[model samples]
Target: MVNRVPNEWLLYCRAGFEPDLTAEITARAHELDEPGQVVAAESNSGFVRWQSRDSRPANGIHRGLPLMSLVFARQSLVAFEPLSLSRDDRISPVVELIKESGWNFESIWHETPDTNEGKSLSRLAKSLSRPLESALKRGGGLRRKAGGRRLHLFWLAGDAVQIGMSFPGNRSEHPGGVLRLRHPADAPSRSTLKLEEAWHTFVPKEAWESRLHEGMQAVDLGAAPGGWTYQLVRRGMFVYAIDNGPMAPGLMATGQVEHLREDGFVWEPPYRLDWLVCDIVDKPMRVIDMVERWLIKRWCREAIFNLKLPMKKRWEEVQRCLTRLEVTLKAEGIEADIACRHLYHDREEVTVHVRLKGER
Candidate 1:
């Protein structure tokens, strides 16, 4: 008989979003036939720990949960039980565990939750990182190679650490799954980072030249102050900025943007556009409806938009909107790729990217 044991998984999310991530993971686990219970889900903790119902091996949970399919989770990994260490020698046990596991890692990430308490542990994590790496190297457990698994040392306290591993392509590239970006000096608003991060998250870097190249015609709905429009302009795309509100003088001076004082909801493009971006603050369903209409009409080949979610049942609302959009597109025989994420720069909204297949 196969030996079965409970499995634990760690998921990181934005503080105050722990409930949503827990609900989502529970629902997903049920669907995958791997029912589990939350072992640790403190409100505003910025992290959650879940364990299976003692029915499968440790690897079962990892096989079932794909990090990309989860909207709220910033990062997910197979985590071991927390370890209590002496203040003097925090490195030896961790090195011993990796050596015993017989796993090689491409790199090691010393992480902490995205919270005030977590921030306080940063120095502790940093101080131990080099010694830990050196110890792991001495133990022959650390090897830097492309496509290798990444070992994570998540610090919960001065004496508590959780050891975990995340697959290369299946996990966020950044530590704690937060992509820290520097704001450009000339950008009109910090909101510009949302669109910029969306591109980095959804679109492959190699395809940027072809997909976001020069001379492309684009449209920015709700383009006031031109945060989103600035990204397109910087990429050398000619933009039709649609809004009744005044735009930034610097963006207009670039001669790459044509300001159209019109309502984004009702305006129609004169011809097909290469890209369509919307950052309108409205009901999530209403925004989704407009985006659906644009795609069905073939008004744009690709789109990046935001869905401002409701306070209650945010994840459920997102599911309903995405499911309906996908089903409607399928009924109309439109092939497209859709991805959504609760971006680092986003507060009460999620960024979505959709690209129609076979459309240049």
Candidate 2:
């Protein structure tokens, strides 16, 4: 029920990675023969817009370049309007514009930038959502059905706003492309949230009970303090927590984990394992080699690892490592679905989730 602007895209990404995202978007636009320019205000400002150079009408970016195929962005939308609301009552103008467009929305999300000032808008956005929905529903511009699309209100401020539309399954389910996860009080470390977020992203909840069952074996590389190990043992899986440092008392008391004082790089899995995890502060290439070995040699069925990035040429490093992994997987005739993300909780690193791809 929503309309897309011709050759315009709205991409949401992590803060401080705006330049990398801009480059990624421009490259894709060129490759698709739809060259465009990116309009961004500053670095680490959260979201950016892609302006198309082509005057001819087209389907925008959802035709072939799906959001999942793009690594730099967290979520993307096709924009239809950009307005300047320099008044106090913003809902009137926003509603009027949406009504004039002659489109309906299944839902509406009031998104803000991932900056300090942006975070302050949360209260205002919450207060505005109900009134906005009421206005849209009264004007017959809102429909809570699968056939309708979602409306995105990128509220940069009271005066600047962008109206975009995203189809279901084509955009992030998490608001503002940020996963709002709660930290467990008993969790060994903050790193636990990273693995928890990974589970929600790559694996389905129903499958977890079966796939990560009791007595299943797992290896936690560099698992000092046992953050990732905490998640596995909580699920009743037998974990080999490999680290030279001490672990949390609560984690060890569970009796589901065995602390191994050894180097993660030099040690090898005793046998095939269900899960192999790594979260070490090291070079990206070395970690890639270890993951490649485990997967190539069939030492584990699945893995979740972290790759530390150098500040300079960060995206280039991601692409280089990605290419290496893809090439090896293809040569080995192994079917796998690998997903990576610059998580909201992560800083200067990305979390990867890899699993065997079931044949059709």
lDDT of 1 by residue, 331-358 (tens): 9999999988898999988888999999
Candidates' lDDT values, in order?
0.87, 0.81
Provide TM-scores for the models: 0.95, 0.92
- Residues 22-124 of candidate 2 have per-residue lDDT tens digits of 7666777778877667766377788877766653323455555677677667888877546777567888877877777677888898988888888887777
Q: How many backbone clashes does candidate 1 have?
A: 0
For residue 237, model 2's alpha carbon misses the true position, in angstroms, by 0.8
Candidate 1: clashing pairs of residues: none
Q: Cα deviation in Å at residue 84, candidate 2?
A: 0.5
* C-alpha lDDT (0 to 100) for residue 140 of candidate 2: 79
